[model samples]
Target: MRQKSVLVVGAGLSGAVIARILAIRGVHVCVVEGRNHVAGNCHTVRDQHTGVMVHAYGPHIFHTDDAEVWRFVNRYANFKQFKNQVKAQVGGGVYALPINLHTINQFFGKTFDPNAARAFIQAQTTPVIAPARNFEEQALQTIGRDLYQAFFKGYTEKQWGRAARDLPASLLKRLPLRFDYNDDYFSHRYQGIPEAGYTDMVARMLDHALIEVQLGVRFDRVDARGFDHVFYSGAVDGYFGHSYGRLAYRTLDFETRSYEGDFQGCAVMNYPSADVAYTRITEHKYFAPWESHERTICYTEFSRDCGIGDIPFYPIRLVHEKQMLAKYRDLAAREAGVSFVGRLGTYRYLDMDVTIKEAMQIARTYAKKAGVAALPAALEAAA
Candidate 1:
C-alpha cells in the first residue's frame, strides 16, 4: 500500500497542530503557507532595537479552560502565568475592563459590596421586559446606559464599523459583567503566554521528520492532486474563488512605535471614546512579565473593513455574511478529498486553545481513518 500523504494548507496553530498529530501517526504531511513564516497571525519575534517580544499581527494571549489543551501547548514551550488585565481610557479617567466591582466603584464613585453592586447595576438597567433586540439593547439591559456608553458603545462601534444597535444581541452575550473585584478579561482556567514566543512553539510542533513545511508557498484546490487528502486552513471563500461573494470580515491595522520606557503600563489599554480613531494600544513587554526589558514596544490597533488582498481577522457574520457563508459551505460539501479547518476555513473567531483542540481532534480522526472530516462548530459559532 502507498504511504498516506496529506497536504496541510496554512502553517498557523490549526495547521501546525494537525500536521504534528498526523506526522506522529506516520503520515507524510506537507504544510504550505502563503506567508514567509509559520504561526500565522500569532507570529512573535523579538525587537532588535528594544529587545521586546512583539506580537506581529496583534496581541494573542493563550487562554482556555481545557486541561488537555493546556498540556498540549506546554509540551512544546514553557508558558509563564500571564493575566490579561485590560484597561480602558474613557472620559478623562482610566478604568479596568469587563466592568468589575472595581470598575463600577471607580466609574460611579461609590464603594459597594458585591450584592449591593449587583442591585445597583440592576436598578440602572433600562428594564426591557422583552429579550434584547440588538447589541445596544443588550448592553443597556445588562449594564445600563451610563456604563454602556462609557465602556462599550463607542468602542464596539469603532471595532465593528457598525452601530451598536445594528449588531446582533448575541455579540454582547459573552461579555461578563462581574459584581466582584476580579478584573481578568477572560474567565479561562489556564491563561498565559509562551516564554520563548509563539513562533518558537509552532516551530517545535512542525519539527517532526515526517512533516515538510513550505513557507511563502500558496496552495490552491488544484494543487491538491498529488496528496491523498488536503486540510485547508485558509479563507473558505478564497478556496472556491469567491463564487458566491466575498464574506464580510474586519481586519486590523497596527501602528507600532518604540518607547524608551513603559508606554501604557498594561498589556492592552482600550480607548473606548469615539474621539480616538484607534480602539486599543498594546504594550508588548507586559505580555511576558517574567522577562525584564528596559525598553518597550506598543501597537495602536485600528479596526476596519477587510478589503481585497488584506488579512482578514474577525469574521462579521451578519445576515448577508451568513447567507454567503452557507453558500460556500455547500460548495465545500460538494468538493472531494478536502476538509476546511480553523478560523478562516470555518469563518469564525477562535481562541488559541480552541484552535489547537479542534486541530488535534480532526488530525486524530484522520489518522485513525483514511477519510478526514471537517469540524462542525469547533470553537465559536460558524455562519
Candidate 2:
C-alpha cells in the first residue's frame, strides 16, 4: 500500500509543527511557504552591518503559561530567560507601562500604597458609565479619563486607524492595570526568545527525514489532489479567492533605523500621544540582553489597513469582518481533506504559544485518526 502524504501550507510555527508531527509518524510531508524564508512573521535574521539579530516582521516574544508548550519549544532551540518590560512615552515623559504603582506615583506626583492607589484610581474612574459600550468608554470607566487619554486613546487610534470610540470594548479587556510595581508586560510563567533566532528554531523543527520544504511556493499553485490531507495555515479568505469578500486586517509598516550605540535604552517604547504618528519603537539588541553588540537596530511601527498583496498582521474583527469570517468558517467546515489552523487560517489574533499548542493538537488528531502509534499521555495532554 502507498504511504499517506500530507501537504502543509505556510511554513510558520503552525505549519512547521504539524508537518514535523506527521513526518515523524511515517507520513510524507511537503511544506510550502509563500515567502523565501521558513518562519513566517517570526522570521529573524542577523544584520550584516551590526551583527544583531533582527525580527524581520516585528518583535515576537515567546510567552506562555502552559508548561507543556514551554517544554516542547525547548526541544528545538535553547531559549534564554527574557522578560518584556515595556515603557510608554506619554505627554513628553517616560513612564512604566501597565499603569502600575510606579506609573501612578510618577503621573500623579503622589506616593500611594496598593490600597490607597486602588482607591484613588477608583474615585477618578467615570461613575456614570456602567457596562461600557466601546473602547473609549471601557478605558474611561476602568482607568479614568486622564490615563485613558494619556495611555490608550491616541495609541489605539493610531494602531487601528480609527477612533477609540469606534472600536469594540472587548479589545481593551486584555489590558490590565496594577496597583503594584510589576512592570512586566506579560503575566505568563514562561517568557523568552530563542537564543539562536526564531527562524533557526523553526528550521530545527522542520529537520525531519520525511519532511521536504519548498520556499517561495504559493499554495494556490499546488495540485491538492496529489496529497491525502492538506493542512492550510494561510488566510482563509485567500483559499477561496475572496468569494465572500476579504476580511479586515491591520498590517504594520516598520521604519528601521541603525544607531551607533544604545538608542532608546529599552527593548520596547510605546508612544501614546495623538501627535505622534507611529505607535512604538523596538530596539532589537535589548531583546537579547545576554548578547552584546556595539551597534543597535530599532524599528518604529506604523499600523494601517492591509491591502492587496500586503501581509496581514492583526485581524480587525468588527461586525462586518465577523460576518465575513463566519461565512469563511462555514466554507472551511465544508472543505474536504483540508483543515484550517493558525492566526490567519482562523481570522483571529493568536500568540505564538497558542498557535503551537493548537497545531500540535490538530496533528495529534490526524495521527490518531490515521491509526498511528498512540503518543505519550503527557504529549497528548500538551497538545
Candidate 3:
C-alpha cells in the first residue's frame, strides 16, 4: 500500500474520479457524499411514474474537444453521439441559437451572401466606449437594440435575477454569432449523453472493493485523524466554516411535465421573452433517441439567485465575489492535511470531462505527495 487512507467529501464527478484513481493505486479511500446520490448536480434517475429518465437538478449536456477526457469517460459508460442544436423563441418566431447564418437569414427573411451578412451585422452593432461595461453593453455592441432586445435582454435578466446592464460584460465575452448557416450551439469535436444515465457510470467508477462509500454522511462528522489524508470536495467556504463570508451562487428551479408523444420538435427550446417564467424547456427522450418510448417528458428550467433553502448550481462570480474568492484561496493554500478537489473546492463552472481530468491529475500528483507524509509506515498498518 502506498497511501493508507484519504477522506473525500462530496461524491460528485470529481471526488468519485479522484477516489477511484487513488484506490486503484493501492490507497485506502472513503468518500463522503452529502447527498444520498453520487453524481451530484449531474445526478439522474429513471422516473418511477413514467420510466423516463429525469435530470434531478437540470440538464447537463456533455461536450468537449479534449480527446483524453472523451476517452476517459467512455471507459465507464458508453456515450451516444449527440450534438446540441438549440432554438430560441423571440418575437413569436423560432430562430437558431448562437446567431448563425440560418438564424440571421430566417429572422430578416432574406438570403444574403456571407460577406453581406457579416457587414450587415457590423452595421447593426452599437458603438460604445473602447471597453464594454456590462452584459447589456456587450450584447448591444455585438448586435444593436433590435436583436439584443429580442434575444438577450429579457432571458439574461430572468436567469441571473439581475438587469443585463448591471451584470458584467465578461459574462458574454464569446458572443456566438456566425456568417455561415451553422446553428450548432457548441463547436466541440465530441458531444453526447450517457447511454444509461449518469448514475450507471458513477456506480461503475466506485465499484472497487477497496473503496468505501457512505451516502448522506458529512465529512466533518467523521474523524479526520483515522484517515492517512483527507480529500475535501465540498464547497471550500462550507468546509472552512464560512469564517470569511458566504459566497453567492445561482440556483435553478425545474418544472417537469409529461406528454403523450413529442412535446417539442427539438431537444431544447429557449424562451428568451420575459413573459414566460421559465428560461428553457428540455425534452429527455430526445436525449436518448437510440431507443424510443411511447411518451416523453420535459422540464422547464428557471434560474434564480440561490437562497438559504435552495441548492446552489452556478456560482455568481462578479467583481466583488472575485475579491472574496482571492481571500478564500489564501485560506485554502494553508488548509493542512486536507487536499481540496472538485468544482466547489476549485470554484469554477467545470464540465464532466474537465472535472474527471482534474481529479485524475490530483490523484497522480497526490500519490507522489504521499512519499513526504510524516507517517511513512501508516500504509502497512492500514493493510
Predictions in order: lDDT? 0.91, 0.91, 0.81
Clashes of each: 0, 0, 0
lDDT by residue (12-93, candidate 3, tens digit) is 8888888777776677888888788888888989877667777788777888888877876787889988877888988888
Model 3 lDDT at residue 331: 89
Candidate 2 regions exceeding 4 Å error are 377-383
**Candidate 3 colliding pairs:** none
For candidate 1, give the lDDT of residue 109.
Answer: 97
Record all residue pairs in model 1 with backbone atoms less than 3 Å apart, i.e. clashing.
Answer: none
Local accuracy of candidate 2 as per-residue lDDT tens digits, 1-383:
57889999999999999997787778899999989999899999998989999998999899999987898899898999999889999877899988899999999999999999999999998886368899998888888988998999999999999989989999899988998999988899999999999999999889989999999999883568889899999999999899999998999999989989999999999998989899999999998998999999999999999999888999999889999899999999999899999999999999999999999999989988877777676664343
Model 3 scores a C-alpha lDDT of 0.81
Q: What is the lDDT of residue 236 in candidate 1?
A: 96
- Give the CA lDDT, 0 to 100, for residue 209 in model 2: 90
Structural similarity to truth (TM-score) of each candidate? 0.96, 0.97, 0.93
**lDDT measured at residue 205 in model 3 versus the true structure, 0 to 100:** 81
